[model samples]
Target: MSHDILRRHLRDLIDAYNFAQWLKTLKGLIPNEFICKRWTSEPNGFIITPIDQIPGLNT
Candidate 1:
């Protein structure tokens, strides 16, 4: 595979694993949820909102 294709596959695998972990261990809250909650409490710590880190609207 080309570099871009390989990178995409790797990212997909990571996302799938993360989703499973959230379902199995994290109680349906994503790893990003921690960041998002912190972002809510402390906006100065982040340059961008972690809401974008969430999986929604396919973005």
Candidate 2:
């Protein structure tokens, strides 16, 4: 329902699907600075950080 909730759900799905690795792969293929900038900017806007950077994920 709400936009914020929907975004969170989507983000959770992405995380569940291991989308960060996909993003990194896509970024590598594209070789665009703007894409890299956009990817890095997302966490500041959404409270979502990379799963790999999370403490529990590394364990």
Per-model TM-score versus the true fold: 0.43, 0.31
Task: Report the lDDT tens digits of candidate 1 across residue range 1-59.
Answer: 79999999999999999789777775666568766776888999998777875777954
For model 1, which pairs clash?
none
lDDT (CA) per prediction: 0.80, 0.63
Worst 10 residues of 2 by lDDT: 46-55
Predicted model with the maximum TM-score: 1
lDDT of 2 by residue, 1-59 (tens): 89999999999998967766765777645334444456587756545444444345445
Q: After superposition, which runs of candidate 1 have C-alpha atoms over 4 Å from their true positions?
A: 26-59
TM-score of 2: 0.31
lDDT score at residue 12, model 1, on the 0-100 scale: 100
lDDT of 1 at 37: 70
Candidate 2 backbone collisions, by pair: none
